[model samples]
Target: MKLWLGTGLVEEDVAGVSPLDRGFTLGDGLFETLRVKGGRVLRLDAHLARLAAGARVLGLPLPAFDFAGALRATAQANTLAEGVLRLTLTRGTGPRGVLPPAHPAPTLVITAAPLAPPAPPARLSVAEGTRRNDRSPLARVKSLNYLDNILARQEAAGRGTDDAVLLNTRDRVAETSIANLFAVLGGELVTPPVSDGVLPGVMRAAVLAEGARERSITPAELATASEIFLTSALGLRSVRSLRGRELPGFSVAEHLRTRIDGA
Candidate 1:
């Protein structure tokens, strides 16, 4: 497969990033996973806006290039009609300490892959291992440091579930390992606020714009939810069960799916 590297496309085998790159060595980078449908990258503007936000947070200078063109080139080069695009930007190689180098050159890589088949209804468990650090600035940025999420997902797998819901330091619902959480609580669609360690997902924004409210949710409240769902760049998936309690309603997810797909 071909991938976009910095300013042009290159064969995957030949594309290289220095092992000393901070993104690989220290997880000092940002990434976006974008969906491509019918050869179009969906929500390009929103994705770029979010990327800019992350760059600002990290104080990293973005590469001076055609971001949209590069994304389109990667997808087109791969002949991707329905698939995903992952854009990774890093601070490049740095000195031997935690402090980044002055006048750093950022590395930009964009890769495309076919979309996986629709996921099955998710089975979730509350993570017991790690909690999302809502107080950390990185919590709001889609950065490369994902060990906490990885641990939670590992915990879920060990518990025989598809994913895990990560709570914040305050023990409030934050989000699932890979998606934003939404529930029909008291018959109103709601998701956790970004202040609660939520990543401010692009699809989550789309859902919120459709009138889903944002608020703090407790574990007890989550248990009483009539329907639950997850939102990510790919789309929405209804929750089959949470913590072993069966949640069998998909109407809200399906309705939102229809609306999003039509958008």
Candidate 2:
């Protein structure tokens, strides 16, 4: 397989990252996952805009490179007509300490993989171990620090579920470990606002544009939702159950999928 390393595309085996890279050592970096269909990248501008937003938050300067061209090249090189592409950007090598150097060279890597088969309807569990920090700036940034999400996912696995629902520090529904959460509450589709520790997912924005309202949702409210679904760069997925209680409706998810896919 081939991948795009810093400078240009290189053989995956020959590609390397320095041990001193801040992204590896301290998780100081940002990444964007994109979907490519029919050899065309979906929402390329939005993904790059989000990446640029994250870079500003981290005070990380983006390198002078054609990120879009690189993405296309990587996908084409891998012969991936339909697949997922990931662009990872990190503050290159740095010395010991949390303080980043004044001048830093960013490390960028883009890789492509064949799209996995569609997953079954998800079963979710509420994460009891950790809470999303709504007040932190990082909550809105897609940074490299994913330990919290990993923990929640592990907890869900232990419960024999597909994913975990994370509540904010104030106990309001935020999102799932890997996707934005949307539920049909009282006949209205609602997803938590970014202020509620949501990640402002690329697909989430697209769903919102479809008329889903943004508001704060409580745990109690979530349990009574008529329908629930998850949105990520990969696509929309309906929830089969939450806490072992079967959810009966996926009409909303289906409709949105049809509309979005057609668009």
TM-score list, all predictions: 0.99, 0.99
Off by over 4 Å in 1: none
User: What does the lDDT read for residue 175 in candidate 1?
Assistant: 100
lDDT tens readout by residue for model 1, 1-263 = 99998789999999999999999999999999999999999999999999999999999998778999999999999999999999999999998899989899999999999999999999999999899999999999999998999999999999999999999999899999999999999999999999999998999999999999999999999999999999999999999999999996899999989999525
Q: Which pairs of residues collide in candidate 2?
A: none
Candidate 2, which ten residues in sequence have the lowest lDDT sum?
254-263
lDDT of 2 by residue, 1-263 (tens): 99999978999999999999999999999999999999999999999999999999999999888999999999999998889999999999999999999999999999999999999999999999989999999999999999999999999999999999999999999999999999999999999999999998999999999999999999999999999999999899999999999999899999999988524
Candidate 2 residue 41 Cα shift, in angstroms, is 0.8
- Backbone clash total for model 1 is 0
What lDDT does model 1 reach?
0.94
